[model samples]
Each structure stands twice: as C-alpha cells, then as structure tokens.
Target: MATYEDSKSPEGPSSYPISHTISASDESNTNMPSWDSDDDPKNPYNWPTSRKWALTCLAAFATFLTMMNGTMATVAHFEISEVFNISETSFPHSYWIVTTWALGGACSALFILPLAEDFGTRPVFLSTYLVFLCFLVPQAVAQNYATLVVTRFFAGGCAAILANTAAGVAGNVWSTEWSRSVPVSLYILGYMAGSSMGPVMGAAIFQSLGWRWIGYMQLIWFAALFPVYYFFFHETRGSAILTQQGKSKDKGNDSVGSEKTATTSTSSLRNLTASATRPMILFCTEPVLFVSTLWSAFTIGTLFLFTQSVEQVFMEIYDWSVTQTGFVQCAIVIGECIGWSLNFLSRKLYLTSTSRNTEVPGAPIPEARLYMAVFGGVFGISGGMFTYAWTSYPHIPWIAPAISLTMVGAGSVLVVSGVTDYVVDAYSHYAGSAMGAVATGENIFSAFLPLATFSMYNNLGLNWASTMLAFISLVLSLVPTLMFVWGKEVRARSTFMNEMTEDGSKRSDDMV
Candidate 1:
C-alpha cells in the first residue's frame, strides 16, 4: 500500500506515494527502482562531492561555449562586412549580426524549455548541441549577408538550450538553496567569461587567420566537447527518473504503478505546457517578477550596448588596432571577477544570517537576495557609466574609463544573479519557467538594444550618450532597492510563490 507522511522534515513534504513494505519482499519488488531513501545512491543529491563537481564543470563548459559563440562574431563584424561589400556607413546594421543570435535564443527558449520539462534535460542537452553543429557548417561557408545572418539565427536558437537549461541542471543535481550557490555561481562565471573572452578570441583569430576561421574554430570546439558531454551526463530530473522507475516495474504485479505512471506523465506534460506559457502570465501579474525582469533586461541591454560601442570608442579615440581594442574589453572580465567575489561574500552573509535560526529551512528572505543587487545596481553601474562617460577624451588616460567597465560588469552580475536566485527560491519546482521568463526579457533586450549604440554615440556624442545611459541605469537601480524594501509584501500575494512555499518548505512562514 502507498503511504503518506506529514511532518515538518528537512526533505520537505512527502507528496510522493511510497510503498513502505517493498523493502521486506525482495522478489516481488525486485524490479522497483525508485530512490531507496532520501539518501539513495541513485539520487544526484547523495552523489559524492567529486561527482557533483563533474556535472558542474560539464554544464559550465557548455555555458561558456554558447555565450562565447554569441559574441565571437562581434570583433569579426568589420571583416565580414568588408567581404560582403558593405560600407562603414552601414555598420549599425551589422549589429543585427550579433543581435539575431540572442533574438533566436529568446524565441527558441519559449518552446525548448517546456519540452525540456517534459522529456528530460538530458535529451534537450544532447539534441541542441547537434543543432549547433549543423548551423556552424552553413555559417562557415556562407558567401553573402543573408546566408550568414540566417545561419547565425538558427545556430543561436539551437544553442539557447545551454543558457536556458544549465541552471536547471544545477537545480536538479543540488536540491538545497545553499548547496546550489557555488555551482550556480561557477556556471555564471563561465557564462560571463565567455562573453568577455569572445571578442578577444575573435579579434586575434580574424586579424591573424581571417574571419572564416572564427566559424571553423567554433566547429572544432563543439566537436571536441560533444563526446565529453554525452559520456559524463546522467538523468537528474526527479520526475523523469520516477517515470523510468514506473516503466521498469514488472507487468503483472505493477498494475497500480502503471496507472500512476500514466497519471505522472500526463501531469508532467501539463506542467511543461504550463511552464511555457506561465512566464507570460507572471510577467504581467507578479510584481516582483516584473521588477526583477525589467532590471535584469535593462542591465543586459546596457552590457550589449557597451559591447558594440567599446571597440569603437577605443579604436577611434586611442587609435588602437582591432586586436588591442579586443584586449581592452578585459575591463569587463575584471569587473566580473569582482562581482563573483561579491557574490561569494553575499552567500556567506546569507548563510550566516540565516544560521541563527536553523529551525526554518528553504531559501532565506527574498529581500536578502536583493541587498547586494540594490547596492550594485545603484552605485557600481551608475558610477562606472558616469566615470566612463566624461573621461573618454584623447588626452585622458584610457585606464580611467576602463576602470569603469569593471564596475559595470560587477553591478550587472550582482543584479542578475541576485534576482535569479530570488526567483529560483520563490518558484522552486517551476524555477525553470521563472528563469525562462527572465531570460526571455534579458535576451530580447540583448538582441535589439545594440542596434542603436552607434547612432546614439554618433548623434549625441560620446559624453552625453553614455551620460544618458548612466542616467537610465541610475533610475532602474531603484528597482532592486524597492524590492529589497518591500519584496515580502510583493511575494506574499504571488500564487506561484505561495504554492511553492506552502508545499511544506520552511520558507513559507519565515515572514522575511
């Protein structure tokens, strides 16, 4: 008989039915393959520390490749434009070359994430990499603007799975909020490093070997990584693992299990579909989500804006070569390192503050996640933008403005990571969809915003144009501050947050 338990346990609610007697009868239950206990060897949660790190490294590697591909073409834009017979006068249009990748990711994640929820992260992970390879071949040999743009678009759509689902993989393997921080932070580090490194790598390759080698290099790397991915990865999604266990049961004696299997599959499908569409609803209805999405999207938009404008600024004012300009982009990387450090410190603060009351569990107060973000968004980004804005003259030391890039990078990650962790806690099982909602907005901004970078810089002039951006960043910084102050009130009314909380997690009554 199936059993139910309802006590406040560290594992949360015992929602799943368990056959308590199965362990006593070896033969009759021999085929059953569900987790033996919360500490079962098959559960990713109970895996050795070495094993967990392996999964983290694999996911981070994939994230790096995806993000690297997105921006590698940025530094090669001039060469690609020259070959297509396009003029510097039309350079702004070339932003589409970069934008389309993010646009494709934004569009594809809507469907891909849902399917991942249904089938399992393992299938989506493998299939999308194949899609990446397929598009790289066309992009490598493309002779015209249309071919290159179309190929990059599809390649980006395929690669969306990596950015959208890697965190979900981390979520699957590490069940607790605190346990997830380091791995998730590492994944974000790889992702940001890829974005920072893309231009540098592309610039070196294009200057030495020409633009086509960019695609060739990407293909070679993907080919090398695919095998590592296929071999090391295992199924970590709990629902999917349970479904497999149901299928493995003996036919005659497992009638009840079969019926339960059908019900679980159907329910999973419904949840998948719901997750696909739920972001739209939450975007409109959930105040916290709305604010967090807007802040992150704007931060990403500014980052892309810098990506397009930074090379031009250094090249035009400092008269740096393309390769040198790419090196200058390291400002953002330094900033990201600092941001990661701040994230580490923030995690320590969160753990220490909450440890005072180990009686409760789940994520700490949602607002606690926003404290660093509020400060980061308000000061780090605004300070960097203003400093960079006015300091960009031929006489001023380039290091002055470059230092500002570090601040921008730090602020962006703090805001992005903080808001993301907040949403992940708030929406737990549906974290995939919650994160998808955020990525949808973030990528949409990334896709379209850079197109105006040159126009703004040229028409408004450098100081004022960047000043304008700084003003906007300063204004939006209020979002996280507001969230930090009133986040609980905002979360209290959220149906999704409440459901996840009341599902027997200690976070529900913490009243933070």
Candidate 2:
C-alpha cells in the first residue's frame, strides 16, 4: 500500500521484494499511498459523484457501441443480400456482414493500444465512435456489395478501436481496487444483450420498416453517445494525469530546474512511451498477461463458436423457427448476466473491511479472483459441452441444447471476466497493450472460429465436433486454475511484472 512505486529503490542484484498481507480496506493512515480519492483531490478515485458516474456511463456506452456495432449486421444480413442483389447459401459470405467489422476491429487492436498513451484514452475513444458511425452512412446509402464491404471494413476498424479501448477506459477511471473488470463485465452484459437485442430490434424494424432502419437506429444511438463521451470519461493515465496536475501545482512555486519539473513535451513523450512500449512489452515479455490473454481469447472464441454452433443442432434436430433461434440465444444472456453479477458481488465483497485480509492474503494476486474462474469456468465449459454434445441427437428434447447454451454462456463469462480482471489489475498502467494482446487475439479467434466450425461439425458430426470444442475449452479452463495454484511463482518469474513493481517488492495494490 505504500505506493505501486516505492520511493526507495532496491540496492541488490534484482532480488524479489517482500510481500505483505496489507489490510485492503483500513485505508486510514495505513502507510498506503493514494489509497482513497479523499486523499488526493485530483486523483480519479476522488472525483465527485457526478463525475464518477459520468465516466462509468461513458465506459459502459463505449463498450456498448463497440458491441452493438459488432453484432448488428447479423440481423441486417437479409436486408444486405436484397440490397446488394447477391445470392449465396454460404453463411460465411453472409456472415461477412458481421465478420468484416469483426476482422477490422481485430486488426485495429494491435495499434490502438500504444496510441492510448500519447493521445490520452478519451480522445482515442470518442474519435473511434465517430469514425464507425460515419462509415455507416455510406453503407446505408451504398449501391453495391463492394461499397458495403469497404464501408464495413473501415467502420469495423472504428468498432475495433472502441472495443479494444474498453480496458483502457476502465483502467483510466478506476484504481486497482476500483478496477475495470466488473464494469467490463457489465459492459459485456450490455454487449451480449445488444447482440441479442440488435437482431430483435432489427427484426422488428425490418418488419415495421426495412433493414436500412437497422443502420439508422445505430446511427442515432452513436450520435447521442458521441457527445456524452467527449464531455465526460476523464483521463485515467496515472503518470500523465498526475504529471500534468503536478506541473500546474508547481508553476511559479518551484524553480524551473527541479528534477520533477519539465515541459509539456517531456510529459507527452513519457506518456507516449508508457502507452506504446509497456503494453507491447507486457504482451511480449510478461507471462501472466500473455497466458491470461490467451485464456481469454480461447474462451471468447469457443463462446462465440457456440453462438453459431447452436443453430446447427437446433435446425437439424428440432427444426426451430428463426424466432426460436433468437430466443435460444437468450440463454447465453441469462448465463452471462448471472456469472457477471456473481463476480461483481465478489469484487464488492473484497472491497469491504471484514472481507479484505480474511480472504486472499494477497491483495491483487491472480489467485484473488480465481474463485469463479476455476470453480465456474472449468466445470461450466466441460459441463455445457458435455450436455450440449450428448443431448443434440434427434431423439433429444430441444430444451437440452438451450440449457447447454446457458452453461456455455456462464462458463465464458467466468473465464473472460476472471482473466480480464487479473490483467486490468496486474497491468494497470499498460492496460492497452495487455488488453490489446487479449482483444487482438480475442477478435481474431472469434473471427476465424466459424470458418472451421462448419467443416468440423460436418466432418465429425454435431456430437463429435461439439465434443472437440468442449475438449479444447476444458483444457483452456485449466489455465486459471493453474494460475491460481502457481500464479505467485509465475509472477515471481515474470520479467515485466517484477519490473513494474516499484519497490522491487510485491504489493496487493500492484498485483490487482
């Protein structure tokens, strides 16, 4: 709690720092630096209530727009085909309406991370939203598939930026204790909800009006959101914000030659370097972030595969309606919401005084959040796979697969949320790169998953193909548990995590 950065530097040859079970909640004179917002007026943690919610809403909305844009095309594919005058049974070509945006978003993730540092997260965020919405106009007005594809490509890039930036926004707004995972989980809830809701909305709009109405609705929603983000979502880069505030406070009071005093250019360069290098460095260099990101990417891919995979079973076995298909998708929503809600509650519990030391003696260790990741994700992933795999036979009831989808949803949440929280907490300052690793891989996996899903299911049959997916998920689910059991040693061995520890000692605040 002294500070993520220790005022005293280590004197020996790269020895590990001491670890302590600090009382996470008894922040009063607790030798903890910047533990509470009341301790520092300029700190994001200390922002007024109105300001706090403003930022929270912005983060949620940013996540929402990213997600809404990601999935809205699925419902519009029918309209797109008619408008473009194309005919194809291949779901991929039709799915490209959604996949194009997904590909663009996935590709953009590699760059937006480092950019977050130099520009400050707020500017990067608002600009991406505007860009995505702008591309829609051309699509809405396009005369051919080429134009639509191109428009979707660029617009998807904007969506990627928005989607990838969710971590940066959360990191910028919250402390390690107030970290972004729950908000991320909530926004994910919005995302899944939007995916389900967008199609439903698009269907209603298509019935009442036309598919163009889908783009129109999104345009309207983004327009309203863009301005709100500009006015709120205060910068959360600790060094950049503090460095600026410190300069202002130091103006005219201190000599021009003090060690801490410097021109705006110096701060800009540092922020830029911190933003660009650290996240990439973490991805390339840190084991924890890498593994966590991979775990997240794998889980998200399998979860999304299930998004399309369910239809194969339902149609083949039960011969359900399109409405019934959409309704089945709701099971994922139910599961994800429940999983996220439970984790959110756990996070809140860790924040309480009595729950602090009594739980994980380590404040922010990956182990701290493992309660759900292992217990929920591992079992849920396999259980859902097993249930869905064995139950989709023609003889089985339709409800069996729906129940399995719900389990897949819950398992996905458990895995994604837990890994996400650890990365957000562990790589607080370099969240862009850390999250970038995950987001980049995540969308890549999500985008490419369906390409293989059909062939795999076709060749192996539904039962075996699904079982294959379940087997993969089962292996990946063990990642969190492995970390939970050996995370401390993993951190100890990590070059980046150790380097980031200010005192060369581990602290709960730093770990989280």
Candidate 3:
C-alpha cells in the first residue's frame, strides 16, 4: 500500500507521493488545507496513541478476514470439485477455484487503490466490503461451477481493498519511520495468520457442515463486520481528510482551491490514468523495484502453492485426513510468529543505524532493512524447502516436514515485511507506485503458481518438484545481500530517483 499526497509541485503536473512530511513552514504559503497546527486534533498523526492503535488493529483484523477468505477454500477443494463434477485428473482448471480469488484481487487492486485515493479510505472500505459480502452470498448458493468461479472473482475483487489499503492506513497513522514498523508488522502478522489458519478452520467447517458452509461462514463474518466498519472506521488518508475539512470550512474560498481546480474531468482522467499506469511503469523501469518485487512475489507464490502441496504430501505419505492435514498447517503460523519476533531486532538495528548516520541526521540507511530478508531468504525459505523436500517419506517422522514448514513461514514473514519496509523507505516519495508494483506481482504469482502445483508434483514427483522450487528460492535469496552491497549505487543510477530529487529541489526553491 502507498500513502498519497494531494499537493502538486509548482513546476510540473500533480503527482501523488507516498509520504509527505513537509513542515508547516514549508507549506505556509501554499493554497492547500493542512493541519491547523502540529497538535491539531483533526490530524490522524496527532491522535491519541490508544486511538491510533485501535484503528491499526481494526485495519489488521480486516486484512486477516480478507486473507482467510482467500485460502479457506483450499481444504474444501475436494468437496467443491466433487460438487461441481470437476474431474479429479484436471491439471489446473479445477484449481482455478482457488486461483481466481487472487487473480481477482490482482486485477481489481489497480482501480481500487486509485478509488480509495480519490474518495477516501472509509467510504471505499465500507462500500467495497458491502459488495464483497453480497458476492459471498452467491458463492454459497451457486448453481454451477461457472457461477461459483465468477462470484469468487468479484468477491475477491471487492476484498482486495482490505488487504492492500491497510498498509496505507498504517502509513497515515504512523508518520515517523521508526514507529511505523510496529503497525506494519501487525498488519503482516494478521495477513500471515489468516492465510495459515484458513485451511485449518475451513477443514473443521467442511467436516461439520460441508463445503458450502465455507462460503456461508465468510458471509456471516463479513456481514457482521460491515456495521462495525460503517460506524467506527474513520477516514485516515491525510489528504482526503484535509479536503473534507476545506469543504466544510468554506468550499468557495478555502485552501483546497488548487485541488478543486484539478477536479476538472480532464484532470481527473489524467490522474486516474497515471495512478493506474505508474506502478507498471516503475516495475518495468526500476531495477531495484523489479528485483525486490520479483523476490517478494516468488516467496508469496510459494506460500500459496504450499496450500495444495502440503495437503497432498501429508495425505498421501502419512495417510492424514483433511482435518489432520489442515491442523498441520499451523506449523507455518508458528514460523510466522517467530519471524515476527525477529523483526524487533531488525527495528533496533534500523534505529541504531539511523542514529549513527550523523552526516544526514534523519536519513536512515534503507539497506539496514534488508538484514532480516537475507536471513529469511537463506535460512528460512531455502533451508525449509530443502528440509521439507527431503524428509517427506512414509518411514520418516511427519514432524520433520512440519518443522520445515515452520521455517518457511518464518522466512516468508521476514522477507515480505523487510522488502516492504525497505521499499517504503527507499522510495518514500513514490512509495505508492513501488508498493503497488510489488503488490501486483505478489498477487499475480500467488494466483498463478498453484496452478502448476498438481502438474509439477505429478510429472516430476514430490521431492524433485519441491527441490526445483527450493533451488529457485535459494538463488533469489541473494537479492537482499546484493541490495545491501550495491543498493545505493543502484538508486543513484535510477531514473526515478533522479527525477524525484529534482522534483524535491524544485519544490524547495519554489517554497523559498
């Protein structure tokens, strides 16, 4: 997720930067509404700590729910296949039931993020969630496979807002770099927990109430949450809030005149077009972003692939039931918890590095954020994958593979969260586009990777298929270390970075 600013540079067209921390003095002459003072109650950044945390937790919970919904169908895949008369031998088509959800999210997110930026997070959250709930009903009552797949796509689209926007909300509430990691980590924890626990909980539901109940449970949960969000969820996007304040005070002669002028249909279309295209532009043009997002995507894709592969390996080798296989998925959850605990150390290291950088008082080294990512990629992901691959035998104890899963989970958290933090810091001005690129890649990979699961396991055998994936991960694991070594040079040569610096210098001159 990316935070956005409404302020435009005097020398160029309006652009949405990821974070804007300009002091009041810097903006005093600008015709835009800002917080009345640093202590203004209306500023989300100045809200009571307890209140900020409350919203953070709520946003995290929403992420948990949406992610859980994404994978809960995994445990019920067999039942759904049977219900829809899908052939057991169908290579990947049957798996589309799970894949479409992520595909929908990926496809819709480009538009959804822009919509949130235009209107406000609160209304977008509420409206999309309501639509998400409505789509869930059809999933519960689908007449055929097409109906189920179609409805899942739309439901997933609506749900994308929750998963992607929570980070933006986190950025809105936590203005400082040092304090921002806590909420972002919480958000990642919620995402991982929901993803890991979904199949386990869904297995229980499927056994007790059948597969349709999976959809029913989602509907019930989402329906219950709608009212709570409607009543309590406040707009946290700083620019959106300021826009509202301007309108409320005096629409005709307010500080929002510049924003109003940019609202013409031509300008609106241009902004929307830029919002939709800029992420892809950055993803393709920036080497740092390309490599970072690719690494994150592979890690996330492998996680989703495990949903199917884990069930297959355990059920066949150990003769575990669906419910039992589901329970074992908790190993990943355990690993994620350990990875999250390790993040505190990373945070401490980040603070220490920032304090030591006296040459640039407040500019922390972004490479400091990659320490855990390197550890995660090398030990957590690659080692776990190898261990799991070589240990899955009928004679071997099941605990071996389970423990490996724990390693993979922990590694996943470390890598994903670390990359996110690094990108946000490295491209703070355009964090929105950078993060958007990463999110899109993640969804694309997650959506398509599992489609190869059955075919790969069948053609190459379980051990070899797993080994191939592990090798790919192992090779990619070096990304963090390479970034740590040469990231500054890479940034220096980056076209985007140079443009941003030029823009910032131009803005400073204009303010002066």
Tens digit of lDDT per residue, candidate 3, span 1-512? 11222222211111111122221112232545667776677777777899888888898898888888888878877777888888867575666766788888877775655556656667777878878888889778887999888878887777677665654566677655445667778888887777787887888888899888988988887888778887878878776777677677865675556556555345557656776788899898988888888999998888888888998899989999987888899899899999999989877776566555432444445577788788898899999999999998999999999999999999999898888767755665566667778877888898899888988988888798889988888888885687666766776788666443333322222211
TM-score of every prediction relative to native: 0.87, 0.77, 0.89
Clashes of each: 0, 5, 0
Q: Rank the candidates by lDDT, best first.
A: 3, 1, 2
Consecutive 10-residue window with the lowest summed lDDT within model 1: 15-24
Clashes of 1: 0
On the 0 to 100 scale, the lDDT of residue 107 in model 1 is: 80
Model 3 gets an lDDT of: 0.73
**Clash pairs for candidate 1:** none
Best by lDDT: 3
lDDT of each: 0.69, 0.58, 0.73
Ranking of predictions according to TM-score: 3, 1, 2
Angstrom error at residue 110, model 2: 2.1
Q: Mind giving the per-residue lDDT tens digits that candidate 2 earns over 440-460?
A: 677777677766776687779
Once superposed on the true structure, which residue ranges of model 1 sit more than 4 Å away at CA? 1-33, 88-91, 250-269, 352-363, 428-430, 498-512
lDDT of 1 by residue, 1-512 (tens): 00011111212111100000001111122233556677777666677888878877887777777888888878777777778876769447666777888888888876654555445567777888887898998777888988888888888887777654564555556655556667777777776767777887888878888888988988998998889888987666654575466566545667776676676567656655665677798788877778778888888777777778897788889998877777778888789878988997776655554544232454344456667877788778888899888899999989988998889989887877777666666665445456667888988888888888888888988888889988888887775676555555655677777654454245433222
